[model samples]
Target: MAHQFSLAYLTVQGCPPPEQIEIAARTGYDFVSLRPIYMGLPGEPNYALAENKELLRQTRKALADTGIKLLDIELARIHDGVDVKKYLPAMEVAAELGGRHVLSSIWTSDRALYTEKFAELCDLAKPLGLTVELEFVPIASVRTLAGALDVLRSVNRENAGLMIDAHHFHRAQDKPEELDAVPRTWFHFVHLCDAPAQIPTDREEMTRILREARLYCGEGGIDIAAIVSRIPAVPFSIELPNLARVKELGYEGHARRCLETAKAYLAAHPRPQAICCA
Candidate 1:
């Protein structure tokens, strides 16, 4: 079987509602991931939960028109102390919109509390038929692959898994062996983007590079080839943070470049046959 890939549009934070589907379709992406459908703004009133329903409807119609799918939804900003209720509705909407997965982050200052909360969230998500994928961020509570694996183990739910971001893998200084250690069944989603060789000292600066300057798969210094070779089969989502460049080149041009680069990288290092899940 051939590997499946998707393109995430979080690079365009303020992307006009009308253009979202257009961009995804024009880019030849298999699916699009949206953030607002799962996570809401921190400390602000939780109006987005109600406000997002219509947006979800529009997004679904847009996908229908463009022939693209909404693969996943990310709740990236909901901090540790926030109520999980604030995000569950978004998860429901994501399911309603035909998304297969919901992404989240561990944001608590207390590691133990955060772990417990994450496990609880996983339990909550199980009955909804949604997979809770924890994405490890360098500045968040679970800052490394090992940290994510620990949380997943604590959760101990079949629906819980990891969403590996290439930037975080490199930022955490994880080795290829770390990738090899991930259980094939627990690898749920993959985010692809590449950064420069020189690591940044400042967190904000580092985030900017991850969001904006990342090159396509084989165009940069990241060891994506080796990482992809070890993982079980999962949808690879390209999330380059260069919206301005994308706008300049137009969707087709930008997507073709990204896809070609990824194909070249995968060609150079073929993945082993994935272990089938029940």
Candidate 2:
């Protein structure tokens, strides 16, 4: 069977969940990811779908009308001053909208504490039939596959797994072949995008690179075909959040380009190297 692809929330950050669902379906994506929680700086748009009943109703209707599934709801952070329990309302809303996973990250310096919080979040999600995927970013505390695996091992939550981002993996200087050592079940899905081989040495610059600039699959330096081949069989979320390009092409056009480029890459690579994992 072919892998199901998603139109990630970042690809059209300004769109509300309902609009995103419609765009995803029109662009031929099998699933769509939502960003109900605000992760960026203030002054940005946040749909806050959990608190908006009417919006959720509209989003659910969009899903039903389009037959597009909800891939995940982002994002929960394991940092200070933010209560994980506060995410429950949003999680509940996402669940109601047919979301099956939640994207999360840890930023604090404290590892053990964050692991506990992640496990607790998993506990809360189990009843809702949702899994928590910890995505590793260059600026995030869990910055590499090794770091992400360590936290997953520490938490030991069946509902928690690591979400590999191709940009982050390349920036971390990790080889795709290294995924052979990773447990297959640890990966529920992955964020697929490409970037230049010249990675930023500064964390702030790296953050900017991830948030504002990313290339569509097969467009930049990342060996996306090799990376996807080495990783376990899982769906790919097209997370190319190129803000400038969105301004040039508009939301629907940009989304169509993303889906088209991803499909082109996949079609080019008909066979993938098998990964051995237990």
Candidate 3:
């Protein structure tokens, strides 16, 4: 199958649902990634799995109308644990909306518990034909590549895998060799972004890093081209949170620039030649 690319919805947090869909479609993105937390504030009215049936219906209709696939549902925070009951419903929603995977992250102190919870969640997801992707965040318990791999080993399920985010990879200062250590098959999804070397001092600083400082694929100082060349081919998603600036330039203009930057990066370093042919 051809590799698919997506623009994550977190980049356009302030926009309405229809505008988000339109932006992804206009940008030449084949898929759209949704983060449930981005739907609304914690206590405010929002699309929780059980209560948001109409909103979910609208989102599905929006994708159908716009021709942009809902590639995945990102559970940005898993504070209490995996919450199998909550997650199972979300998996149903993902399947109903045509999403192939569910992206999630857990707190650092919860890692041990998550190891067990994740395995149970995987068993629940398998029957539904869904894959659970664990994203390692800089602030999360599974911050480093080593920590992520350990969790994967603990889960030990065929459908459980990692979501490699370039930003987090750099933030965690992951060693190059760690990439080779992971069985390429363990990665189910990848999120792409670039940032400068300066470290953040606070949450606001980190937010700015995500929204303002992120460079387009090849334009940044990060060795993203080299990194992408090493990893196995998967469904890569461009997550330029700073691209919200594109709204001022218009959606098509913003998307064109993102795609052009990505193309330039890929051309500079083609995929690494396989050591052995299949």
Local accuracy of candidate 3 as per-residue lDDT tens digits, 163-196: 8888888887886556776777777678877787
| Runs of candidate 3 exceeding 4 Å displacement | 1-3, 37-50, 201-204, 243-247, 250-256, 275-278
Ranking by TM-score: 2, 1, 3
Which whole-number lDDT from 0 to 100 does residue 273 have in model 1? Answer: 64
Error of 2 at 243 (Å): 1.1
For model 1, residues 69-168, the per-residue Cα lDDT tens digits are: 7778777343656667667777777777778888888877676777777777777777878888889888776788888888888768898888888888
lDDT of 2 by residue, 10-110 (tens): 88888888888899998889999998887666667867787777887898899999999998989898886567998998899878878889999888878
Clash pairs for candidate 2: none
Clashes by residue pair, model 1: none
TM, every model: 0.87, 0.96, 0.85
State candidate 3's TM-score. Answer: 0.85
> lDDT of each structure?
0.72, 0.86, 0.71
How does residue 188 of candidate 2 score in lDDT?
84
Alpha-carbon deviation at 18 in model 3, angstroms: 3.8
Q: Least lDDT summed over 10 consecutive residues: which range in candidate 1? A: 38-47
